[model samples]
Target chain A: LGLGLTASPLRAAGLEPNSFEDITSYNNYYEFGTGKDDPARYADQLTTDPWTIKIDGLVEKPGDYALSDLVPQMTIEERIYRFRCVEAWSMVVPWNGFELADLLELVGVKSGAKYVAFETVLRPEEMPGTRFPVLDWPYREGLRLDEARHPLTLLATGIYGKPMPNQNGAPIRLVVPWKYGFKYAKSISRITLTDQEPPTSWNMANAREYGFYSNVNPEVAHPRWSQATERRIGGGLFAKREPTLMFNGYDEVASLYQGMDLRKNF
Target chain B: MIDVVNRSVRAIPNWVLYVAGAVPVIWLYVLGFQNALGADPVDAIERNLGLWALWLLIAGLCITPLQRLTPLRLIKLRRPIGVVAFFYVLVHFLTWLVLDVQIPSQIVADIIKRPYVTVGMAALLLLLPLAVTSNNWSIRKMGARWRTVHKLVYPAVLLAGLHMVMQAKGFQLEPLVYLAAIAFLVAMRWMPLSSFRQAFVKR
Candidate 1:
């Protein structure tokens, strides 16, 4: 098990994982609250045990599967990815999980499925942010069928070899390194396969600011801020902002977006 | 009771306001030095300084309304408060320029291209002349014209509030509240004196 962990080919090269303090304390989980520190303060109220994920829509096996039963069947590995936010901040995280392709194969995707939609669990009793309509409640996200089936796509279950922190999406979460961090739905409750394009929370909130395909392209700027550079979190007080790269330095995903105009798709 | 409150307010030196105003910036610097500002100290420092400036500016604007409506008189210390607020605004601008966006070209582009940055820069420019001529000598030399020049603060405050509202990610309540408070204060100056007198007489 130790040998397999160190030899994982998915580890990002020439990057250091952010300190556990920074990773756990700083998050953008709006389900908890909008402030960076609100999640750390309020997320402990979440109940993750006995959690079950409802998988339905155009799948051969459609049922609520216990997290325990699903996790044991897959081979989990460390995937150090460069996590970038649409707000122009970046961090390196060591996430441990199996591929989404592996999970989809286990359930079997119908041939006609065109998109995969994800929904976050909304428990107003525990998540205080739900009282206000900061975002349309029960945040949702989706990806193209090809994007969801990409090998780099992940369903992260742990961080730094430890159980995921409640603030950082405790039981399970999605991680698409090539896209912005918001694309990674947290504390997911339901995942559905559909033929039509599905709506995402940020895109639904403001289509002009956020697009369905939120690929990290430095050439494409957000309507409010420039994406040319990103400030590295945990780089100390005087750290200079490094120039951002296309796909957040993941050139492997470029082929996936081969002929599409990223500016329009952004 | 009103007399005692007015006398107590008058007893406090103007220098005390200036000294107290310096404490927040000094404490923020100390926190930055100790690495206690969480993961992103630059952003935290920049936001805190800007908020302090806005709060002080709003407090300075409240003096006229307070005197008009109630017996509380903080008029004597308004100059010190305005000067201290300008100082915080200057530091906040410097933090953004020096620490957050270091590239000179990018800084110039941001001021030109970004609407929020453009409005913020306009507010800072408007405050420059007012801060430079805040002393008694300028007031005496210019006489009534000093009041005209000082009136620039109304537009400056409005622009600052707009800058705050525009920069937020979503529709946040804090920035909106600041803008609303500023709008109410600015409107108070335009209200007819008869209404205020009638309200005071009734009270």
Candidate 2:
């Protein structure tokens, strides 16, 4: 099961993980609010205990499984990943979780399944941002079957060896290292395997700016801002922006795109 | 009440506006040094400066309409408010240039390629001439042309509001409210005082 236990090239390259305060405080969880600090301020209202993820659609096992039952069966490991936001900011996070592939294998993916769709838990009363129509409610995200099965893909349960903070998607969250941070759905409640391509929230909001496959590529700039460079969070006011790498420096996932023109896909 | 307010307004000097304008900037610097701007200080600082400039621009625009609609008069302070707004705008641009986008080539490319940056730059350019001729000597020398030159604030404020709307992540209400406020203020310039009185009286 331990396929690539080798030390991450990102860590080997001397990329220090951001302070836990930086990771927890500065978040893009729109469920809490739009401001960077909104999640830190408001997400504590969420009730993550006794969580159950609803699993259905083209799976051999389809039911509401409690998070406690799932954790005992899976092998949880820590992955240090470089997280890049579509807003042109980056952070190195020490995430502790199991691979999405392991979870799919346990659930038993059906032959007809071509894509994996995920949904975030929406409680308008708890989530203050949901009161406003900032986005279509219940933030949705998806991945091709191949991308879902990739070893790098993770459903993170904790950060920095500690249980995940409510602000940073407590209990469970998706983490696709190569893709932009928006692609990773937080505080996930549902996982569905379907043959058809699923709609993503940001792409639905503004198709011009956010594409379905939001892989971090410096060459394809966001309509309103450049993606060529990214400011590292927690870097002081004077810190210079470093040039962004293709696929956020995880070159192994480059095979996922093969011959598809990223510019058009972006 | 109007006489008392006007007398108090007359007592205050224009230089006080410039001194008042420096307060926010100084406060931001102090907060920045203390690392009190949350996790992303650079972003917080950048946004705070931009918002200060926007608020000042809106306040400057309010001067004319305030004088026209009510008995209160602040026409004498308009020039100083505008000049201070320009100063804030200049500092906001510098923050983006020096702190946010440090790369020189990317800065130039952003100004040319990105629509929001282009609009913001255009607004800054429009405000430049107004700030330059804000002094009494230039106003005396230019005579009637001075009013014509200062009229550029209308388009500058419009562009600044548009820039704010364009740069926001989603369909945010804050920037939209700023845009709506600017539009209403600009529209007020065209309507006659008699129509404003009629509309108020009808209600």
Clashing pairs in 2: none
Q: If you score just chain A, what TM-score does every candidate get?
A: 0.95, 0.95
For all candidates in order, state the fraction of native interface contacts they contain. Answer: 0.47, 0.69
Task: Report backbone clashes per prediction.
Answer: 0, 0
Writing each residue's lDDT as its tens digit, candidate 1 over A1-266 gives 88656555433353678888999998998877878899999999999998999999989899999999999999899998999999888999999999999989999999999999999999999998777777887899999989999999999999999988999998899999999999999998999999999999999888999999999989987877788998999977788998988999989989988898888899
In order, candidate lDDTs are 0.90, 0.91
* True-vs-predicted CA distance for residue A208, candidate 2, Å: 1.4
Q: Which stretches of candidate 2 lie over 4 Å from their true place?
A: A1-12, B201-203
* Per-residue accuracy of model 2 over A1-266 as CA lDDT, tens digit each: 24334445445674678999999989998889998889999999999998999999999999998999998898899998899999898988999999999999999999999999999999999999999888998899999999999999999999999998999998899999999999989999999999999999999899999998999999999988899999988877777799899999999998989999999998
Show the colliding residue pairs in model 1: none
Name the 10 consecutive residues with the lowest summed lDDT in model 1 chain A: A5-14
Candidate 2: TM-score of chain A is 0.95
Give each model a TM-score.
0.95, 0.95
How much lDDT does candidate 2 score?
0.91
